[model samples]
Target: MITNDAMTVQDQRTSKIILAIAAITILLATFAGKMPSGMIGALGIMVITGFILNYIGDRTPIINQFFGGGAIVVIFGSAYLFHSSIFPASAEQNVTTFMKSGGFLAFYVASLVTGSIFGMDTQTLKKAALKYIPVILGSAFFACLFTGLVGMLVSKSFYDSVMLIALPIMGGGMGAGAVPLVEIMSGKTGMNAETLMSQMVPALAIGNAIAIVMAGLLNKLGQVAPNLTGNGQLIRGQKAIEEEDQSTAPLNVTTLGVGALLAVTMYFVGTLLSSVIDMHTYALMILSIALIKVSGIMPTALEQAAHSWYKFVVGNLTPALLVGIGVAYTDLNQILAALSPMYFLLVLITVLGAVFGAGLIGWMMGFYPIEAAITGGLCMANMGGTGDVAVLAASKRMELMPFAQISSRIGGAFMLILATMVVQAIA
Candidate 1:
């Protein structure tokens, strides 16, 4: 009984007992309408569901390889749960409120954006930045081209396909990309925003889902064709950015606090600039951070602290965040209702075009093709911020959050301009 094996088994039993009790207590509180709101109830439900789904996804055969592992599972699974009434309506509402109103998604992205940029190797970053925009443009070009051609054959209207389907899917995400697009298009065409949104929503949702899967596939491709990927590095000659700074002192509470402060401050600054700059806050913040990093204004100590905070957030909160994305943003019904064979084909074509297009141009620009495709193409094609997080997570390249954000914000903005010009010309 006192043997090591016996002791280990006993420990396992005790841990299981405690977990079971906790789970039951949470379930009882949830069913009895006693689940607390804010961080307490919301985080518990999200983290637990995320962990369960993540475990299943990682263990499943085909899903583990090509379907983005836990990221996709948690997302789709939570969406289904949210709709199926398996989870209490109150719990679902709590998660949705927390993700949206609580600004958890923004908080997560802010951490990554600041931390990743600060941790980047300046030389590689500089090189990559110069070439990144071209890759994004390339993706948009091919995505539109491919979607338009396919739309002509199937729907008999090239303009409708390109404008309605291709552009919206690649425009960024809901709030920044599709919603604004509906307004702009509605204003120009004298159409209802609701009508435009109807076409755009399914496109955005389906495109995001496909993009997440494609990210996973690209990750597997990277495994098969090792040369095509930087394993999170954007350029070939540069080593992957080190997650932890070697010269920095070991992490402490003070450093984490500093990182949190800096990240929040950067986001706030971006928001402030957005009021005057006419650009997305994420995009503005990114530009500011890059300028600060390049100018050598931020202290090395502060940079390390920001990076540490990013690592901590990525490591701990990614799963929980994915769950929230599922409950708050993804609409299973919309995805299912729009699952027509031709619609699926068009959406798939758009995503493929983005990936291949971005990958090809990225290679020419001296960036790794897969990394470029994921950040530059898939990120653009996803649901915006949440999409960026999901795409990067599925690709196993959270370190490239800076480039991904750029693709979403700047790339999305470019789509709006393109859409406006195209509408004006063809109208």
Candidate 2:
């Protein structure tokens, strides 16, 4: 009979050889400028790269401690990798298309949203929905106020700073937040949208990077000061937290399929409702899910299945999704180009202001300060859905995804309306 220890050694050797072969293949394709194309090629590369970089980030000294560990590496590392000349341009385009047009990001987020909301206590869901918006409002108020003051001191243009820089940075991502704001400003000020976009994109990029870093720092803070954070729970001293079922049900393939169906169907419903309503599709989806949970309409087995499917996606696909985000959304070049002492300072203050405002208000409403700052503040400051994923991943608080989506979708819409009013007032 073969010894167990010898068998283990042989298995390890086989794994190493396989990894080495894969690495060599990737290198050869890179130098030859002949990376495979289409979904198969793009997804394969992203998954391999994500896993390798994630491993390195987790093992590296100091990086795993202060930074976001593997999460940061998978994102920023992939950003640099995709942007470098050594990487094939065709490959980059393929990855981008797969991430956006393929609906991979939406699929990932819908699963998280549905699962997290369904898994929560019904009463907790009700209380969080009622109080979360106020936290977002608080975050926006402080972020704008701080950015405006600093802009006046540095550039002597408070209106420009508040309108151009602060609003866009806190308004969500480029498409939903900055684009609409620019068009509204164009109508009021007679300036071209292109010119306004040029001015705002840098701030948005830098702000997103800052928010990601802050998320990592906040995660470290939670480790040192557990009292300030509720771990993943937003509410403090809630019975829901105490009563959470620690023993999860065994994995059921059929149940997971049912969960996937429910999640996608809910997203479809959101899309339909959005066509008739003025709200964003994501916002409508969140509201619909929350209502379903509150109404006790969904069966217990289905809810558990949704939660189970969520766990599976987060475990297996998160690194791959981060790779996609790095390739599609993160623009390190833009961030570097916009870096100045004064500009960096203003962006940092704006993010900090958001954290402070949300934390303070959330505490008053019986939510944990760190959790509130992350979901309510950083989510708003980041680059919308992609940013939400990166920030939440860095913070190691994927369970709070439902709240993060609320900040991005609903809060983003509010910023658009606020921008319209501000433009009408100033113009």
Q: What is candidate 1's local distance difference test score?
A: 0.90
**How many times do residue backbones clash in model 1?**
0
**Each model's number of backbone clashes?**
0, 0
- What is every candidate's alpha-carbon RMSD to the true fold? 2.2, 2.0
Instruction: List model 1 lDDT by residue over 88-189, tens digit each.
Output: 999999999999999898899999999999988676678888989999999999999999999888964888888888999999898888888888888888
Of candidate 2, the 10-residue stretch with the lowest lDDT total is 241-250
TM-score of predicted model 2? Answer: 0.94
Q: lDDT per model, in order?
A: 0.90, 0.89
Off by over 4 Å in 2: 2-36, 239-243
How close to the true structure is residue 150 of candidate 1, measured as C-alpha lDDT? 94
| Tens digit of per-residue lDDT, candidate 2, span 105-131 | 999999999988888888888888898
